[model samples]
Structures are given as C-alpha cells and as structure tokens.
Target: MFKYAKRLQYPINIKKKDINMAKQLITQYGGIYYKKDIKK
Candidate 1:
C-alpha cells in the first residue's frame, strides 16, 4: 500500500551527481496545486 511522508524519509546520496537533474526530479515530485480561482 502507498503511504504519506510526515517528515524526511531517508538520506539521499547525490555525490558527483548533476545538481540540475536532482532539482528537476524534486520539483516534479512536488505534484500539482489546485486553486479555486484557477480555471481548468
């Protein structure tokens, strides 16, 4: 089953990895926001 995270899950090792790629991945996981003022 799927679960929600209340805090930091684990320590990620990004040594010698591309910073930009990491940022993009994190942003993508942030999901989408729905606003009442926004139109579909």
Candidate 2:
C-alpha cells in the first residue's frame, strides 16, 4: 500500500479500443499534476 492524493479519479476509465491514446493522455495529465504537487 502507498499514499495517494485526495481526489483519485483524474485518470478516467477508458475502453480497450484506444489504449495507446488513453495512455498518452493520462501520462500528460499525470505529469502535469506531478510537477504541480512537487512545488507545493
């Protein structure tokens, strides 16, 4: 187990039809949030 932020529903559920696209989008979103959090 590990710690997590309060809102844990950012990376929305995705279908298997476009896994690659979903992954890229999630990565971008996650990277932005990650950097933002580090500054806090």
Model 1 regions lying over 4 Å from their true place: 1-15, 31-40
For all candidates in order, the CA lDDT equals 0.58, 0.61
Q: Clash number for model 2?
A: 0
The alpha-carbon lDDT assigned to residue 11 of candidate 1 equals: 70
lDDT of 2 by residue, 1-40 (tens): 9997787656666455775675567668786454444332
Local error of candidate 1 at 31, Å? 4.6
Candidate 1 residue pairs that clash: none
Using lDDT as the measure, the top candidate is 2
